[model samples]
Target: MTSKLTTGRAGIRRGAAAIATAGLAAASLVAVVPTPPASAGVGKAGASPQVPQSPPLPQSTQYSADGWKARPEQYDGMDIERDVPITMKDGVKLLADIQRPTRHGKVVPGRFPVLVQQTPYIKTVLSLPPINWALVKRGYVIVTVDVRGTGGSGGKWPVWGEPEHSDGKSVVEWAASHNRPWSDGRVGLFGISYGGINQLFTASQRPKGLKAIAPAVPMGDLYRDLVGKGGRGYLELAPAYLAAVSGLGILPNTNLLKDPATALKNIQEHWDAAAGNLKMIPEMIQGGDRAYDSAWYRERSPLTYVDRIQVPTLLMGGEFDAFQRGTPMLYQRLSAKGTPVQFINGPWSHAIAAIPAAGVSLPGVINEPPGVKLGELQLRWFDHYVRGVPDPALDRRNKQVTYFENGANQWRTARQWPPADVRYQKAYLSGQASKGRPGALGTPVSGTPDTVKWNLFSGLCSRSTFQWLLFGGEFGNGPQKIPCMTDNRYNDQSGLTYDLPVRGRPLRFTGPVNAHFTVSTKSRDSQLTVRLEDVGPDGSAIQLTAGWLSLSMRELERGRSVVRNGMVVQPWHPYTKASQKPMPKNKPVTVDVEIFPASWSVQPGHHLRLAVQTGDFPHLFPPFPQLKDSFGGDVKLWHDKTHPSWITLPTQPS
Candidate 1:
């Protein structure tokens, strides 16, 4: 009945050149490997009495443009070395590369408690050497560094995580006062994405001896991890991850590339001048007005330091993560401020949680089968929080919450985190015709339903004719039936479906998902989205979490709403502003739509779906085809029984 959609300067320059050639070929394959030294070890711990597993594969060895080195007969008991600098205290030296274990005969170090990471990708080649040789052959000392401006560090890069939280608290106070030889001043931090957002901005600056931190898919909130959800900017991950970290800050390394075909033509002309200066990121965040301005893009956000985090945190994420709502909003703001948090999620993406899960390998690194070992659960969480190891199985109050359900890949723990007993159900949307025909199916209601109609189209075409055939192109199609929710052939009754049906046992849902309903439009302001499916058994619906609003920024912020089991938690609503008046086309108004946190179970005859459309092609970036004031006319959809559409399940705990 009314519509508009934009975005197509040749599909935003071919999605910004396929995200800048897959982020400069993954940061030039993590900068040609070689960093390594600082104490490279492996033999000695118990001198060889035992512990010698990992090594059924991973030994391909092949690094030449001048690095990859390490061949002292391939170590035999393992102990390699390379460059290891660490000057800091404001003089800025950085560059680290340690790996431990050797202490002669039985490698028994005096003090041992360090696990830092600090990355700009390329700590001697996309590190993670079989989880740093299984945490230095099970002794732990690790290191890594190279932040402040990327490898061979110095300064000037500062791309994300609030200037790497004071350079990751000055590389954990210079790895706890260079006490070297595995000396302890206590430290722990791991990495994954931007070294897990510099371990949550150096554990939110609680630095000192640091204590513990894991970070995994962490990015926590640089405007919802690189501008997205609503503040929109994720045009395929910000100009291809800022032209692959500004083409790894102007290529070079291999000890400063001396020739090799003129250093691969000056690293492809500094990756085409950092992908042509990614259209001056909104004028460099409006001339860095400060707040750490890159154009005041919300002052390089981190959700403004979620209450300045306290330590003992873990926070991992993935629901095909692209920073899945900043890792559950840093585990719901560090477990609502009590700290000592945990929270994990799976069914990963974002480089499949740093490789390995297909068969699972670690004998040196390349058997590549295991996808989520997360470096052996971040070395048993930095060996029970930086080596005070009593190992009560990593007790951060036991089960803080964990998830994974790509058709049950297993691993599901929960003492809290969208698991209370789940039972919030609502499915309503009778049919009868109003704007574009076909309705009269009536009677099969449970909650909200009284109106539903849709039909919008304009510029940039394909506003999802079933997500352009279930996620466009290639052969990566697996979870189907989610294009227009059945009845095939792009059925569009302004699409609205809600199912529940189950029977007994097996029905666990997890956090964040909202929808409210009651809309009306013909054009003035429009955009609803809301997905949340599951379906299966033969009908195939999949797609578990999705949300987007824009009906003149919907409103709903006050105490942020809450209802639990019957669904409705609406908190996290940073729409910011936009609604001075624009909803006349037909006018109805109700808007809620949150949808993003997830953790499923379903089972027992399975069904739990919910879909409401307005458009979401290419994973968003459509609305704005001159509707001028955010279009929204003649587009009604309401749930019945006096508007009672619901869905809020985090239940689990017998």
Candidate 2:
């Protein structure tokens, strides 16, 4: 069964509003404190796109962050200082909006710690800045800068290049310096998506007075996390993301009428920058350094510089986020270095995490333990780190990590991620499976290999659509509201599945997953996706984690690939042009697919299934050359004695 979405006025509006849209991240729109909201001036260009408002949370769902509560709002409102210019080292003046606590029409006396957010999206049109005025009212000065080449800021956008990194550090220093009278000389960085990702780059620079950082739903490895889903460009979402930021960057600056010359220059620079980025998409479609994990990708990936970030960090990720594969990687590196860090992995997607549902619940999908409001959690992080205020609750929080384990349906905290007791286990796929029916997992039988067709539209209404679309792609049809996106049954029916029945206690698995397969295809090339899902007795398939691999780029970075007790738990592929090679048609080749990490407890009656399919474009997001190269073919998965296939899973001893 193929997936389809009914597009209409309501659906289209919902889709557009839900995109990260550069300016849409950062504001916590939860049940806010009862006060006249601190108002900030909207940019002459326009206000940020508004999302549908979620209703108030039920009292039972309200969460307290380990007994941590927000500091009292000492001010009635906040006053905005718009179009404030901050000159960078290269003489480019980036425009910023400063929001300071105010009463009546006067600025409050004395200084407050500065909180900085650098956005590629226009700073002035940022969505609902006033909604965050409550944060300013709590004794903090908030500043949001339009990253170079966007908004009123000068200089060309290098697309997350050295210039942006340098600018990030320069901006942090500017906010933390005494040059700004309102600044208390201490700084913390926060934002979502673009705003959030830059914090890592800036903090890695180790600017003075930088205290802490909390990057919500940010990506560490750009190429692997956002650009390249497996070994190809993630066109399913990357194109839209690139187009949005670039297109919005070149828009006319409404606040620049007073300075026509500067405004024209800004537009010209942005147009050129956006053009240069868009040009690379075509190059990427054809195989080149742009398509591979070359220096271009490595230089911009925040993970490359994570070792240098010394500040206390709070990283938030969704189990279903685009960056799910890399958030834990960053967390692990930070923890290994003994850097103060906390990680929260929710069952949310990027959009849900950015503008959460009322009470942390996503309607009928899953209800989260409404923990401390998201904004409050960020406040706590900033207060403890930037403000230097001692909080016993924070000390307790610093020692633990939080995660929402689905299926178990509760907030679970551990001293470390994946819990130390988790052991790597393997479930082998059986060779004896009938045509058009699912096969059994474990205790392999010597029989014929299974086959699957190369079908690009296989993953349409699955979790991948919801995940890749960055919103609720699960809502099928206009007003008909079929819950097909969340259910993997539609996808599984079209793929090859191997299941392992669960008995006695619930078969729980937590942490990274891998699918090691030995296969051959009718064509010289093929791209395949592996999905680890929970199959209920009612025949419902809930995708837990997924991985992708193109046969051409199957060479592993031996040293980087993770192995435990001789089993490859996490396989790392370089995805470089040099590593990419055409496959030998109809020849058996082994592949190790790196599935994203997740913590889920499959209830007793629910069996675990590993699924594989190819031509899933909406999720695979492969570039044109790769997609075209592996366009159509019949692929075979061998599970006979000599060519056994299996999945490596992290499970705890019962």
All models, RMSD in angstroms: 21.3, 8.7
Tens-place lDDT per residue, model 2, 455-570, is 77788777777777665433335211546667787787677888888888887777888888899986767888888889899998888888888888888876898788988888
Off by over 4 Å in 1: 1-114, 121-144, 147-193, 197-213, 216-273, 276-313, 316-341, 344-388, 393-398, 402-416, 425-510, 516-520, 523-525, 529-594, 597-654
Model 2 root mean square deviation, Cα atoms: 8.7
Task: Give the best candidate by lDDT.
Answer: 2
Clashes of each: 46, 4
TM-score of 1: 0.35
**Candidate 2 to truth, TM:** 0.88
Model 1 lDDT per residue over 413-447, tens place: 66666654555544444543343333322244543
